[model samples]
Target: MSGVNEDYNAISSVYSQISKLPLMVLERQLVAHALSSCKGQTILDLGGGNGIHARKALELGASSVDVVDISSGMLKDGKTITAASGVNPAMIRWFEGDISSTLAHLPLHKSYDVILVGWTFDHAETEDQLLGMWRNVTTYAATGAKLINTRLAYIPKAEETDGIEKYGFLYPDYKEIPGGISYTYEAFTDPPLRCPATSLTNTLDFDESKSIARQHGFRDYQVVDSEQMDVVKEDPAFWRRFVDQP
Candidate 1:
């Protein structure tokens, strides 16, 4: 596999593991809360890694969810998790490959009532890349449809030492797991910060990200909710770490 595909494949398993984490539980709740009024609406789970978000949407009674992912490995893992969770297979439609390419190759007949850019936008290499994806989204989304997404703040240039300082935040240090193979993050504030390029893949200021969205015609985004969950808030470094990574 190439770098992009390999990165996704390596994390595909981790993506599945994330669903079991307390942070993921909060993320699910946040999305579900935003989607409470979408019971009968069709949803598009863009970059639906491992289908965890898609499964939750199904549980919330979405009429249907179309899951699009760039990596086939991730989609394959999603199928596994969905099956293990006993989600109704019929509720999900999986599209494998890049979003625009997939759309061009196999077009969806109808617009989505709700489109989820679930941890998706932060990966764009440039503003144009991100905007292009946004244009595609607006093209296929129904009028008044909601697009839920998340991303990290941009990293500052100089005026700082090496490491996470450039990113304006730190990475929460993780304790070695009992087995000593992988690590589990510890609860702490003011831990070590992370690298932005390594974190979000794409770089953009929070204001810049919002500006791009508005430019693409998405309006009425009031950030209805913005509370850090216990696990994330208690450890101030959590969002600066795991979340901003992917």
Candidate 2:
């Protein structure tokens, strides 16, 4: 299992418990916005935990929502979540594998109108990996389809004066791990013991990310929807208009 597997598998039982949390309200909002154009559209949900976003897309009328995840345990929970919601199994296509492997399963020369990566980039092992993920997404998205994702911000050491700024390929502040930029630090702990740390320099800020998308041949790159989120958002009407492609 990859980092995605370990994290989601650990939370499988408690995943739906988020419905009772305060942030669940906002999460639903974000989810709704992310899937607004689902009706008649094809979608890709990468790192779709518990299939919340995928189910929402189906509800909003997406022709299909393909969920690609690395954890079988997490995929199991996703099935439960969708089933509990009465979603038709035909509406969703679940692939239990890493993103790289899942790419091979997608139809060649076929693409989606909307591709979602909610909080997925932070889980990649390297900058090249992140770039590769982006490349894969673009490969499967129809022209002008939107790519939406989020990442945790970067933080600085406690003794440090200024916190690191978020940039392309930087280590995150919420955890400790090797950064994508040329920064050096002693490893005080080992991987698998803690969440992977992200680099402030190597990570993509909003503008830089859009530019990157454009550089990768994505046109009309823009921020369609964004807000502080603590939980899953379920409203498809919120984001469909801005991010949906013709």
Candidate 3:
């Protein structure tokens, strides 16, 4: 719950409600597009809290998934949900450890076909820690494996709001920290939940991040445009604010 990884032990129960937010539409779209080529493939979901997207991967035709997270509570919650939903719990392996430092020691026996990094990298408090995350990416991912990820890259430090409320979730203004910005990411649900997130500039900077990716054996890094997604094309007016700000 601190430093390179913000353990979500306290808010694990309500965190699943994040999918209820309107912005989740785009997230699902991204996942759908990312997983289009992953049929019968294996996946490694770093920071895959509560198996939300992990289950989505299975639904999208992934053969197996390994969900690594820093929170035991989140893993437990995922297991409970997987068991209750009658989705063979064995399909998803829940491992609790910081993705930044534990990939080598974790029980990841093979390189994956796809690596998921969404809602994962922002917690790094320093550039070295951020590199630690990309390091893990290169570790379990072999050449030709797809790496798909996303985050709130833009920092609305000046404006109070970026018109994101309609898209769901409340991302308040962030304050500058040593090497990043810190803010409470709030999801509006019954008995609301908030996560104190730290997004470093190094993590946000495209040049720097992609530089590290290339240096560490990653290639063909490209940012997918959100405007062209079917979800956005279906309703431009509704998704304007999110796509514009996102």
Candidate 4:
């Protein structure tokens, strides 16, 4: 199996559970608020793990939802949960691949009215990759479509161990990088082994992300805090907004 698949499989079972934590729940709420005013029928959930947001989108009156995730394991788990929740299996279409490549090959007839990139773009390891993601998402968006992307902002002097234990993970100070964040946890193990996960934050701050969106033919952009559901930044989570230009 590929390394990415291995990593995702390791955490697939617990992914949904962890996602329901207060912070994550707030993140989803913020995403829903961003789309509350959107009366569109087609929605794309990029890197949408376990279909949490996808299910919510359907409840919000979306007629069709497509979920693209890099992990088949995650998608499988999502299918089971969404099915049990009484969501119609036919309303969602699942695609397994990297977000950038998947977006490139989306059916010509497919154009999203709303695109939700929730807490996943931060995995892009390079500036070029991030820019490519912006471009591809814009390419698949219909004119006047709303794109909402949530990213983790760097918090100065942030706690090295806040809320980690509640999710059954560890955040060791020794593992900290100067300008990035790290998370380590063991998935589905008796003696739970630690898996090292880290991402660099220097390349995709809010300003840089907004700039890229504008360059890719998006306009009327704004930022909102998921917790407050407003323009103020009272929390570490925020979502960027863009409307594709005609």
All candidates: CA RMSD in angstroms? 8.7, 8.5, 2.1, 6.6
lDDT of 2 at 240: 36
Give the runs in model 3 whose Cα sits over 4 Å from its true position: 1-7
Candidate 4 Cα deviation (angstroms), residue 189: 13
The alpha-carbon deviation from the true structure for residue 192 of candidate 4, after best TM-score superposition, in angstroms, is: 8.0
Q: How well is each residue in 43-160 modelled by candidate 1, as lDDT tens digits?
A: 8887776787788888888888888887788999988777788789888988875653336665564788888887566445444555566766887789888888754443323342
Best first by TM-score, ranked: 3, 4, 1, 2
lDDT of 2: 0.60
Q: In model 3, which residue pairs have backbone atoms overlapping below 3 Å?
A: 1-7
Tell me the whole-model lDDT of each prediction, alpha carbons only.
0.60, 0.60, 0.79, 0.65
lDDT of 4 by residue, 1-246 (tens): 126557776778767766544445556667888777665478888878788888888888888888888888989998999889887889898888677454556553357888888766656655555556666688779898889877655422336445334434343432445555655443323445344444446433667666767877767787664436433244332222211100
Query: Lowest lDDT 10-mer window, candidate 3?
Result: 1-10
Candidate 2 vs candidate 4: which has greater lDDT?
4
Between prediction 2 and prediction 3, the one with superior lDDT is: 3
Clashes per model (N, Cα, C within 3 A)? 3, 31, 1, 0
lDDT of 3 by residue, 1-246 (tens): 364234488888877777777788788777777777788999999988888778888887889999999988888889998888757788999998888775777788579989999878878777777878888888889668888878767766546575666776775656888888888777786677777788887667787767766787767887777787887888899988766667
- Please name the candidate that would achieve the greatest TM-score relative to the true structure: 3
What candidate 4 gets wrong by more than 4 Å, as runs, is: 102-109, 155-204, 226-246
- Whose TM-score is higher: candidate 2's or candidate 3's? 3
